[model samples]
Target: MHNIVLFGPPGAGKGTQSQKLIAQYNLVHLSTGDLLRAQITEGTALGLKAKKLMDEGLLVPDEVVIGMIGSALSANQQAAGFIFDGFPRTTAQAESLDRLLAEHHTKVACMIALEVGEEELVKRLLERGKTSGRPDDQDETKIRRRVTVYNTETAQVAGYYAAQHKFHALNGIGNIDDIFAQICLLIDQHKPAVDEAPAAATREVKA
Candidate 1:
């Protein structure tokens, strides 16, 4: 299995790139943000708890997030691998994810972080906000706060993966296809090779 963590702050084009990677790699895309929203939309017990915390502007607990991921993994047993997005925001969460993947006989092959300048990120997010209808993206103050929160709190997760020699950084600028090509190169390097088919048997006829 060639599991990957697609790491980036807001407006780093993770969503766009993830789609391409999923198509090229045949990997399951697991976005915690999407998973939480699905649960909430379905009114699951876990979703209710998450909704309460989110309604209060508080972050959901890591265990809850881990549980959601576990369920996602269970649901996609035939997947070639997974592209994890918007997850493992802290070192603790990273450790938890490692354990979870180990239970399935796989480990994170690499974590590819999209490095973008704050100015560019701000500009992209503000422009997206015009059409995204996302309140957090629309307000400059919220955008800055989100970036600050990522830097101060979430950026350390990179170190967790780095210590395991699974962290890689990519410049997240210029043409989309160009960036994707670079990303594909890196993934191909880290992804495990597929098993070769067994040689056909040669039969000896008895006279």
Candidate 2:
């Protein structure tokens, strides 16, 4: 599979670009937040477990999240590929994801990150808040905190992928179509030539 781990801080246009990429590539959207909500809506055991932890003001364990991802992979055996969003927040989670995908005889095609200046992100988010009705977006302090959290915590995950020659970064301040075109270029360059072939595991990917 030509799986992708799409990364960006808030207001970086990830949502807009992801929609285009998904439709263009016919990739499954494996957003962890959405998956967690699915589990809760379905009343599954894992979902119940996650919801309980969330209600208790505790973070749900990685295993539960991985379990949800594993189930998703199993259920979508026929998917062209998967686009992972809001997952693998740590290097440890990245390692775990590698192991899980290896079990399925497929691997992540690339990790694409959208790079934007913190000030621009803050401006964009605050503007969005005016229309989005999300109080968190309206608060500059909270917005900065979120950006700092991404830099200190989630950003480290990029290194794990980079060490494997699977990381790509792009400037996010550009025309929407221009940015997406660049992202597509990178994915096409790195994506396995044979998506479903058994030999995909050993395919050479361009850095």
- C-alpha TM-scores of all predictions: 0.88, 0.93
Who wins the lDDT comparison? 2
State in Å the error of residue 64, model 1: 1.1
What's the residue-level lDDT of 169 in candidate 2?
91
Clashes by residue pair, model 1: none
The residue ranges of model 1 lying beyond 4 angstroms of the native Cα positions read 52-58, 194-207
- 10 residues in a row with least lDDT, candidate 2: 198-207
TM-score of 1: 0.88
lDDT of 1 at 29: 82
Model 2's lDDT to the true fold?
Answer: 0.87
Model 1 per-residue lDDT tens digits across residues 125-202: 999999999999998889888888877655688899889888899999889999999999989888777611222222
Candidate 2 stretches with Cα past 4 Å from truth are 197-207
